[model samples]
Every structure is written in C-alpha cells, then in structure tokens.
Target: MIESAYIHIPFCSHICNYCDFAKVLYQKKWIFNYLDALKKEIQLNYQNELLKTIYIGGGTPTALDLEEFKYLLEIISTLNKQKEYEYTIECNVESLTEEKVKSMKQYGVNRISIGVETFHKHHLKIMNRHHTKEQVVEAILLLKKYGFQNINIDFIYALPNETIEEVVSDLCNFLKLDIPHISTYSLMIEPNTPFYLNHIKTIEEELDFSMYEKICRTLKKNGYEHYEISNFAQPGYESKHNLAYWNNAFYYGFGLGASGYIPEIRYTNTRNLTKYCNGEFCFNQEKIDFKTKMENEMILGLRKLEGVNLIQFKQKYGKEMDSIFPIRQLQKEGKLQVHNRYLRIPEEQLYLSNEILMQFIDT
Candidate 1:
C-alpha cells in the first residue's frame, strides 16, 4: 500500500557555503546525459505501481532552464501513479522564475518547496546564498500567481551568533507571508561542508535551545501546528511526501545521491555525480537486518507528534511494545508517554530527540 518516489537533481547554479549535498555547477552537456541515465535508472528500479507521492529534490531542481526542465519532467512523470498523486519539487528563490513556475504547473507539479533559509540579509550573506531577500518574495508571489497553492518554505535557525530575539523576528516575518507550511531546521555543521572546513562555529547550545523554544511558541501562536519537530504547517497542510520517509514507508529513489527503501532492502545511489550520470550506480542496495529494520521503525515513527501507534506496530512487526522498546523506562523518565494506543515523545524533549530515539536502538 506504500507508494512514493524521490529524484535527486545534482546540479546547482551556485553551491551554498553550508551545503554538503553532492552537487556540481551546471554543465549543459550532462543535462541530456543525466536525463537518459535517470530514465534508465527508474526503468531498472521500479515497476508500475500506484505512486502516491513523488519528490524531486536536490542541488536546486529549479536550476534547470525551461527546456531542460521539460525534458526532466517528461522523464519523471512516467512513474506509475494513482490519479491525484502529490508531486513536489524543491526550488531556490533565485532560480524559480515566473515562466518556470507556470511551466511547473503545466507539467503537473503539485507542491513547491522554496529554500528561504532566513529573511535577514546578513544571514544570507554569511551563508553565501546567491539570492537576495527580494528574490524570495518574488519567487513566492510568482508561484501563487501561477495558482500554486501548496507551498513549503524552508527556514534555518541557530546560525552562529543568532540571538533568540532574532529567531523570533525571523519566524514572525515568515508567518506574515501566509504560506501554508514552514520547515525550520537547526544548523548542523557537517564535516567537509564549506562552513565546517573553514571552522565556522555553530550557535551556542543554550542559545540554540532557546531559539527552538521561541520558534515553537511563535508558530503555535500564529495558528500553525508543530506537527513534526522541524515542520510547522497550517491545518491539513503537512508534507505528504516527506511523511513517507519519516514513517519508513517503501519508496523508489532515482538519480544521484538519492536513498530509498523497497520491501526489505534499503538502497542508496552513488554520491559521485559522474557515476550517477552513467546509469551504473542506481541499485547499490543492502538487505535490511531484523535489528536495523526494527530500529528504523522505532526511530522514524517517533518523528511525528502523534508518535508510533502501538497497535500498528504490533500489527507490522508481530511484537508487543513491552518486548521491543524501552517505553516504560522512558515514560518513567518523563521523556515519552503512551496516549490512547500511541507512544509519543514529549514536546520539550523533541529538541534533544536524537538522545531519546537512541534509547530504543537495538545495540
């Protein structure tokens, strides 16, 4: 009953200083080559099943010019899908033109995720993002003008030296936009990213925690549900595509650096752009072990505010919660609770979610 797909686009007009995703500056010759390789990969990876959701994400999907975009869409729309499948594409403010927005609507994309990172010009400059604040506004307006109603604007807090006051201000600005959904992320400095290599500091842990609390309060006050730790949405606007990932549902992923799970096997495509461009790197898969699979089920389920359904877990895994998870101990420690038949991590404990989730990891 699970149906989803993920496509990774490895080209970006310019790389962000904080980005660690596998990507390269655009070279037109590889455009057609990548399209061919991606099509072949899809053909090799999945059969025609009803696709409930498809997400085209990466180095900036909107980086492709109009002609190239049409070609890419033509290749992607071939996935087997139920009527009314949700199709999401990630875009950069600078790359999403009015023409591109219209063309996306024409091509059947139903969701648009724009990377807004932050509204402060100083933060954008420090992050080395190529777009200005005006571009972000313009992009959203264009999408709305083209009748694209489902929009998700992504933001990041906890930048080095960011104050809690500043974080609240940023959230207020985004709230004013009337966007349907917002994804707010903490700044994690990954090794090998430009920021990490240059030794850029992250926000102080105390300040970061304060910032997170500030965001939760502001979003709730603005009538957005803090459904997932990182996602805030107006009622009924949660991201269906990403929910598939968090719920550990089976999905087919194609293109460079995409990861997916189908039935019992988990797979990750090659990180090297050259390997991904040749159709030889799509099926590097590893079969899931009992412990790894169980850990995934426990951890991924905890990402939602509603948490794991006890009855559904038993139904899916053929095991009782008392036998599998340390649910009782966590409840005693005030980290988690079972309401009705669902186990949920407490809201305040969410910022330290990794610690709570790891308690259930099977060795």
Candidate 2:
C-alpha cells in the first residue's frame, strides 16, 4: 500500500540562484488555474488510501496569498490520512505569515520545513534569498506559538569561497533556534541555474568534505542523530515522509514536476507549466523490472544508518542479498558492515557513501 504523497506547489516569490527545481515566478493570474489543475491531478490519481504522511513542498508553498494557500489546503484535505498522520508544508521565512500559520494549524499541518539556507547576510545575498536572520527567528517563534513544534530548517554548506568559520557560525545560529530536524546539503551548481550560468564554481573537494565532517560531528555532539546521510534530527523527530523515499516505498506525487512511485511504475509529471496546467501531467515513466527493483531496494535501503535488513531482504525478494550483489566483498573492504543484523556503511565511511553506493549499480 502506498502510504505517502508529495504535492508540489511550483510558484515562488523570488527565485534562488542555486535552485533548479521546476518553479515559476508567483503570479496572481496563474494561482487559481494552477491550483485547479493540481486538484484535478490529485483527483485523477489518488487511490484514497489512508496516507501516513503528506508533504507539501515548494517553490515555497508559503508564497501563496492566504486565500490561495487555504484553498490549496482544502484541496489536500481530500486525501485520506491516517488518524496519526504527519502533514508537512515547506515555507520560506519571508512568505510565512501569522494568518498562514494559523490556517495551517487549523488544517492539520503538523510539520513545517522552512528554507532558511543560511543566517549570514553575504551568503543569503549570494544565493538571492532575501529573508533576514530576524525574520527567520520570528517565523520560528510564530510557528511554535501555534503549537507546531515538528519544525525543520534546511541548511546549505560548501558555497563558493565559504570558510570553515562561516560554516561554524551558521551551525551555531541553527542550534540556537532549537529546531528538531535539519537537512544539510552541499551546494551543487547544476546546469541552467544562475550559479552555473554565471560561471560560479563549487568549493574545493577537500574543503567540502571537511565542512560535511564538521556538520556531522557537531550535530551528533548536540544530541542529534545522523540518521540519514544528510539529515540530522533529535530522537523521535526524523522525517517520516523522507523515510518513505529512502525505504523505496510506493508514493503518489502530484502537481507540476512532481515524481511518484506506485507498485511497479515510476513516473514524473511534465515540468512545463503550460502543459501541466492543461492537464498534461505525465512527462515520462519507466516500469520497474525485477532486477531494477532489487537494485533500488539495496541502493535506497543502505542510505539509513541502520542499513538494510538481511532477513527482510531475503523474505521480500526470495534471494540472499550476497547472492545478488558484492555485499561480502564490500564488507571485506570495510566499506560495508553488518551490525545487529542490519547491513550498513560504517559511520566513519558514510561521507563516501555515494561512491560506495555506486558499486551496487550494475551488480
């Protein structure tokens, strides 16, 4: 049973230089039409299963005016949610308002993930993000006031010319907010983004590695669990929505540019706004064959700190994991290990997880 769904709202008040997601400048004229199309898309695809998690991500879901935002929530209310469901909405500090927060609270939004990439002015300027540190604090306080505490803030490190001190400072500021979850990312200059268009380069590989190490160490020291590679959360605060993805579980993805996995099919919606608004949702899809399914199970399962369960793997696929891949070889190389019956990358080697994961690609 598909137990999760991700809804994308592809409109933002301002575009960040590093963003490559499918999004458009927020326009009043398109809001109604886009939301209408989104509602239709959900109605057509949703199977009315009792979802355990529903994440409403962006292009800043908070960018919508109060009426539009509430309308969007109304549409989402149609989805059947378990009694103890986790409903998350991504917000930007500049766009999150008291009215919206109250509306979200009323509509059963239990989690709020904010895009507070950095607290440094220079870094924010470089990224074309306009929220001040003051605004971020106020937004957090407001969310807390509304009895919403399952908060998460995104952090970006390893920017061009970034220093260790700056990274430390940002970490300090983030800790002060006392939020439970943080998702850290190293900046990647994807093609077509302003950073790539402006010929910007990423920080040196060694420095990037060092910064990631610092983040992991510091967060761990502060009583946060490095549960997934790039995510840290206070115990009991991990993102259930994201865990669905890492588990390779089936989920419905709705709206422009969203992707979904259902049973044996994985598909992405059309990124073109014109096409999406015209009800042309699917852009591409691929059938998951048996070999691909096993590969995906291994690749996605290994992302957790506890790794994959060998017994569960055998029971699900009817084959031993070592019989299918180079698990024994990787364990011999000290890159992978079995702890308490869970196969995982050693904590010390997690920074090289991408490289280790690549070894499973064709096996």
Candidate 3:
C-alpha cells in the first residue's frame, strides 16, 4: 500500500537563482483557482489509504496568505492519516509568519522544512534569497514557541567563489538553531536556471569534496546521524516522507510538476500551470518493468547508511541480489559492503555513489 504523499505548492514570493523546480511567482489572483485544481487532483488520485507521511513542499508553501494557506490545508485534510502521521510543510523565512505557524499547528503539521540555503549575506544575495539571519532565527524561535520541534533547514555548500570558512560559518549558524534535521546539498548548476544563464561556475571538485567531508565530520561530531547521502538528522527525526522515496515505495504526488510512484506506474504531473489548472494532470508515465524495478531497488535502496537488506531482496524478487547484478564484484572492489545483513555502499565511498549506482543500470 502507498503510505506516503507529496503535495507541491508551486508558488513563491521570490524565485531563487539556483532553483530549477516548476514554480511561479505568487499571485493572489491565481491562488483560489490553483488550490481548487489541487483539491480536484488529490480527490481524483488519492485512494483513501491511511498515509504515514504527507509532505507539502514548494516553491515555498508558506508564500500563501493566511486564508489561502488555510484553504490548502483544508484540502489536505481529506487524506486519511495514520495515528502517528508526520505532516510536513516547506517554508521560507521571509514568507513564514506567526499566524501561518498557528494555522499549521492547528491543522496537524508536525514538521517544518525551511529553505535557509545560506546565512552568508553575499551568498544570499548571489542566490537572490532576501532573508536576513535574524529572520531565520526568529522563524525557528516562533516554530519552537508553538511546540513544533521536528524542524529541518536546508543548507547549500560549494557555491561559486564560496570559501571553506563561509561554509563552516553557515554550519555554525545552523547549529545554533538546534533543529533536528539538516539537508545539505552541493551546488549544481542545472540548465535554464538563472545561475546557469548567468554563467555561474561551481567550485573546484576537490574543494567541493573537502566541504562535503567537513560537513559530514562536523554534523557527526555534533550528534547527528548521516542517515542518507544528503541528509543528517538527530536520532528519531529522520524524514519519513523522503525515506519512502529512497526505499522505492509507492506514493501519491499531487499538484503541478509533482512526480509519483503507484503500483507499477511512475508518473509526473504537467509542468505547465495552465495545463495543470485545466485538469491536464499527467505529463508522462512509465511502466515499471521487472528489470527496471530491480535496478531501482539497488539504486535507491543503497542510498541509506544501512544499505539494502540482502534477505529482503531475495524475498521480494525471488532471486539472490548477486545473481541479478554485480553485487559480488562491487563488494570485492570495496565499493559495496555487507554489514549486519544489509548491503550498502561503505561510508567512505558514498561520495562516489552516483558512479557506483550507474553500474546497476541495464544489468
């Protein structure tokens, strides 16, 4: 059964230079119509299963005004949730308000993931993020004041012309928030983004690697678990919604530009807002064949620190993992390892995971 759902709210007050996600500037004129379309889409797709997690991600879900935000929450309330469900909403410091926090608390949103990419003023300007460090601190304090402790802040490292000290300083500022989760990402200049259009270059490969290493060391030393490749969290605070994706589990994705996996089909909604609002929900879908399923099993499952479970693999696919792929060979090359019956990429080799995961393709 699909136990997770991700809803995308594709409206932001300001677009970040590095963002490539499907989103548009917030317009009050479009808010009600978009929410109505979102409600229709969810009603059509959701099977009424009790979901363990529901993540409302962005283009800054908090960009909506209080009434609009509450309307969005009302639409989400239709989903049947488990007894201990985790409901998360993405926020930006500038858009998040005290009234919205109270609304989220009342509507059962237990998790808040903020897009505080960098605390450095120069980096913030470069990314077109306009929030001050004080605003971020105030947002966290406000969330905490409302008893919302399962907070997460995104951190970006390895920007163009960024220094190691700057990265470390950002980390220090994040530490002061004392939140439970941090999702760190190395800057990638994707096509069509403002960064790519402006010819912004990434930092050197070696320096990027060093920054990743430093982040891992510091977060680990400070009692955070490097549970996934790009996620660090205090124990018991891991993102259940994201874990569903990495585990290759089925989920419902509602709203424009969202992608979902359900049973044998994986689908993405239309990126065109006009098309989506007009009820043209699906843009593309691919049937998951057996070969592709097994490949995804390896590629996605190995992302976790514990890796994939060897026994579960056999039980699920009715074949030994080594029989289907080059598991034994990768193990011999020290790219993979078996620890406590879980097959995983060794911690030291995780940075090269993309290269290693490619081997499973077409195997």
Alpha-carbon local distance difference test for all models: 0.86, 0.95, 0.94
Q: Could you estimate the TM-score for every candidate?
A: 0.97, 0.99, 0.99
Query: Model 2: per-residue lDDT, tens digit, 1-363?
Result: 999999999999999999999899999999999999999999998989999999999888999999999999999999999999999999998988999999999999999999988888998999999999999999999999999999999999998899999999999999999999999999999999999999999999999999999999999999999999999999999999999999989999999899999999999999999999999999999999998999898889889998999999999999999998998999999999999989999999988999999988887
**Which candidate number has the best lDDT?**
2
Model 1: per-residue Cα lDDT at residue 109: 93
Q: How far is candidate 1 from the true structure (C-alpha RMSD, Å)?
A: 1.3
lDDT of model 3, residue 208:
94
TM-score, structure 2 vs. true? 0.99
User: Where does candidate 2 clash, by residue pair?
Assistant: none
Against the true structure, what is every candidate's RMSD?
1.3, 0.6, 0.6
Off by over 4 Å in 2: none
Residue 363 C-alpha lDDT in model 3: 79
> Would you give me the overall lDDT of model 2?
0.95
Cα-based lDDT at residue 166, candidate 1: 79
* Winner by lDDT between candidate 3 and candidate 2: 2
Model 2: how large is the Cα RMSD against the reference? 0.6
Q: Per-residue lDDT of 46-73 in model 1, one digit per residue for the tens?
A: 7888899999998888899899888888
